[model samples]
Target chain A: MPDRSVAGPLTDPGPSHPCGGTSPRTGEPDGRPATAPGCNGRVTAPPDDCLARNEWICGAYLSSRRDILWGAVLQHLQLTAVSVLIGLVIAVPLALAARRWRWAAGPVLGVTTILYTVPSLAMFSLLLPVYGLSASLVVAGLVLYSLTLLVRNILAGLRAVPEETRQAARGMGYGPVRLLVAVELPLALPAAMAGLRIATVSAVSLVTIGAIVGYGGLGNLIYSGMNTYFKAQVLTASVLCVVIAVAADLLLLLAQRLLTPWTRRQS
Target chain B: MNILSEAWSWLTTSAHWYGQDGIWTRLAQHLVLTVVCLLISCLIALPVALVLGHLGKGGALAVNISNIGRAVPTFAVLVLLLLTPIGRFGEGPTVVALVLFAVPPLLTNAYVGMREVDQDVVRAARGMGMTGRQMLFQVEVPLALPLIMTGVRIAAVQLVATATIAALAGGGGLGRIITAGFNLASTAQVVAGAVLVAAFALIVEGLFELAQRLAPGRVRGGNTG
Candidate 1:
């Protein structure tokens, strides 16, 4: 296991050499001493003399900015995408079982409610003993976190199906499985999507906390800025996060519109 | 037995970090942080909502703005504010972020609550020669009390949870314990901090439930009655 003792403070210097002393803008070292170059600051190490370069820019904006932006975007997408996918896989069945048994809702909702109450940082810390400092732990924590929203949404959607519709399906001699597949699932899609929307927004925000455990993402930018006291980088990351949040929200809106055409018409 | 002993030792040590004459000296610091954030948010949001609900103009714009606020994550806002001039001063940034985080629910619910008042009651009040302010205070606000209370309940719960993030920004609270626990790999500390927060949420929720129960009967049963 990676030594937890060596884990640096969330705020640390970025890539600049230790010899450079304090950055003019940030009172801390040019780069956090504990983290690698580019982990905290705008500085990029040159390909040939990666060790020697002290300047912030090693290449043109296209190469450096593109890499950092894509890195942040990709990290964010992966974190949210994995959690949502796993949450859906788990939540759908649990929701379905809750519908079938009725008794299952009590336990299912109870567990998820407790999980929801656990703060994200506390949850991450709790998992460290079992999973150590790995991406698996982060993903598992996030997936568990997403389940509350997904399950509630899915169940609400399922419960909202009219009694007449269920009776009609039964009249047609459809089994539980078939009825669920064809009727209940479609009707429940909007509510499920609403849950998915809430889960996705929540996941995007919570993923930033994963940076605390060295699981890198856009949050790393914010944390790095804070550590080194890099106001500009901190600002940049913060703005980018807001932009990303807005963009993701808009994307969901579009997705909701596309998938639930009936909803669009109602509006 | 060994684990139990270790836990006991940790608990005793933890007391040093809590209570007056402890780590930060008293719970007042955290309470102040939470209460001030809530009070400021209510003060700003309540008036805007009252005006919009009374005037019935710009209702759409006010509502749309609140909706946008819902979309903005509180943590992200906290981090973003860290970069601005205001954020440089530490806790001020956190307070600003918390207020923004809180305003939407309070504003939306207050506005909607007031607007949902019985139209005939409002008309009657007006016909009785009550001024608009008088109508709002005497008729609409009382009628809207329950719904407004519901908004406050939600805001209270949200504020409690989000207050933990303030620790990351150096605004003190139970979050400091949680973060320190994470850094130290102390599961007990983490659990303790989390349990306290959850407990706090439950207490606030229960208190709000009591408030709802005690609301003036006219407001509580006005609809059904």
Candidate 2:
């Protein structure tokens, strides 16, 4: 509406786009008015782009979708981090309770196992009523799924701390709280970290299921790409998810080794 | 607008459960898809796992491969396969993606389970004039049944859950009900669909647990999926 008369170099649709864009909304361009004056304000697809070619591995798509892909990646990471952290926070106390009281273990483990068995789709759908299609729905579902893994491992680690070790700690003037914080928790790191690694990796994979909702991050890109059969976006986003999962697992494994150097191989 | 009551009514409606796209049809599709995928996965995974586990070779490689496989998101695989030429074959991609998914757990458990069987038992079987096949099926497999059942159970339950992806790719499943609800903006249908899928998965899991409980060799294998 401002000035269609002046077709500047920036507005050049190039030799490819005879009409501006395929989008019929003339004059008011769909996105980033790349229309030129020569074409009579009818913006069209790019003349020579991988996007137009619909190639599976399009560098142009990557460059153009850099922000979108990056945003999806970031959102994916944020969701994974937040849910796993929250899961950890909630799992520790539950693990402790399960370990402290014999009666609580069955109920805690039983409930979490049942939750884990719930399909991610069903889990999200079930939660949709409560969380209302938001990212929290994904996070809440993930946290609950993580509970089965985290609680079991954390409890196992705590249990694996030998009675002799506990007695020794107590003999050294360590109270129950101090023994737990200083000795028991550190000894429990190996198993707990293994659980964390698995939980984080699985969470990375599960976050893609969040695409069912609008907040799936890379999952959103993947979903829309799949709908449109956008080859490059789907491939790229899926590969990125894999890379993130492997990277997170490796990072956690490294952390586990560093934290529990005693568990390292003799070599 | 109580969601529970709405969902209850949605479920109670006779019309919703009596057509080609009815709840029954969808549930059957979901079950069939799940069973087919599980069968295919078992066929592909069990033999390889049993062989590798029996040989005590490639166990590490197999396990590592399965680890990588698990890292790959099932949804991405589903979409990727759907986008590829395989998508031309109806439900091919969904089946492939699900088989790929169901394999890792089955293979890992079977391989680990087979490898974990007591060596003394294997020696005793060999001493009793058992051939490799005989030792494998009779002694090794029997010893590993608990873990093998665990793997089968895990894979079965997972397939039941993930088969819902079939609906996304234009196939039939319980997921169609949910997606249709989304399209129609019917929260009740969505809830009803979700409840059905969740309940179905739980029932599958429970049945497996029951089978494992009743089965011999209560060797507490594969404690976690």
Candidate 3:
């Protein structure tokens, strides 16, 4: 909607001229003897105007690239980190309780599962009445979405711990709290990390949807581009999102590898 | 009229509306979209997953890719696609975005189900002169079906939820009603839309559960653990 008239001049290629008339190096449009063809039977330097046009294109590309890379990465990291932290705080306790009391698992899983099955926007709209169109609503929705995966993984990891290990820990005079913290938790950490990884990636992806409600992120660029039918903006944002996803995935995989060396050895 | 009678009147009216081009029509469209997206994604993902599962070398990579795919928000993808050349085509973008949204679970389940098939059973099938193709269809697939069904179940639920995002792109679905309710600040309408969606998801899930239950013992037995 902003004045697009300014872009008109840039898009105009202007009048065509013979390629050999002007000095390609100076780009001053001065009449000069054309440069001789080199051993490859072609002039290495482009015509001066062509070089200028290419320079303009390159500049545009660089600026857009920088804007997208920095903007998307910053938004993605901020959203994922805060959401995952909040999710972990809630999920870990719920998971532990679910493990200790089998009955609690049903309701806990049931609620989270149902919440998980709600669409992101619908969930956002559900919260909007209470929280308004604010970042809090977005965060709250994301945190809820993350709970199912985190809790399920934590429970699975705990349950997967060998019964022999639990009995041995008990034999060592370890109380329930100590057994959980010292023995069971370490073993569960890998699975917990896997869950966190999934949660973090999901949070990053979902944060883009937050743009719809004015909680700006990389998705903002995507939405703006789409709304206006801007291919450069759309392609740039989409590619950036994929790159961010892949990068986050690799980084988390490395972190998981570092945290659970036993996994590496077993594999 | 008393509140009970008024409520019943509203319910009956709503049911009549549903019978028309009202909530039921929207719900049916949304359900169909959800089913088609989920079914197509499952169909496409399953074979690739089975191949990967058989290879086993890139299980981690395949799972990681699917996890990343699953993580990307459907709405984000929907909105992002709206900007492309494809976005000019409108609803096509929405469908593609939804398909992308549904692919991860389908792929993961198919791969995991097959990989989890008992190695001894696969070996015995091979030893009994079953070709690799025959082993996969006759032995492995039967054993993996339950897990694969679980994956389909998960994908089905997810797609139903995610299809609401299509409404944002101006595609018709129950989400249109929900979004309209939001725009108008009508909680009842929003609640109505949500309840309908939830009911739809539950119904589909229940049907899939029944199908899973009715599957042959070879398909359903070992994977429950």
Candidate lDDT scores, in order, read 0.70, 0.81, 0.69
- Highest DockQ against the true fold, candidate: 2
- First chain of candidate 3, TM-score: 0.75
Q: Quote the TM-score that chain A achieves in each candidate.
A: 0.78, 0.84, 0.75
**If the candidates were sorted by their DockQ against the true structure, best first, what order would they fall in?**
2, 1, 3
The lDDT, on a scale of 0 to 1, for candidate 1 is 0.70
Best by lDDT: 2
lDDT, candidate 1, at A224: 65
TM-score of each: 0.81, 0.90, 0.77
Candidate 1 residues A1-267, lDDT tens each? Answer: 101121333433543333444343433223434334553565554222222232233333224345665787688779878988999999999998888897899999988976776657657765765676777778888899899999999999999999999999999999988999988998999899878877877777787777767664667766665555455555555556657767776888788788778777778
The model with the greater lDDT, 1 or 2, is 2
Candidate 1, B1-225: lDDT as tens digits: 343344346656856566643445324555677788899989998888888998887678667665576455565566566655686575777788878877888888888888888799889999999998899898888888777777777777677767776666555666676666666776666555555555665677778778777776765644535
DockQ, candidate 1, vs. native dimer: 0.28
lDDT of 1 at A104: 94
Better of 2 and 3 by TM-score: 2
Candidate 2 displacement at residue B62 in angstroms:
2.3
Backbone clashes in model 2, listed as residue pairs:
A19-A42, A20-A42, A20-A43, A20-A44, A21-A42, A21-A43, A21-A44
Which of candidates 1 and 3 is the stronger one according to TM-score?
A: 1
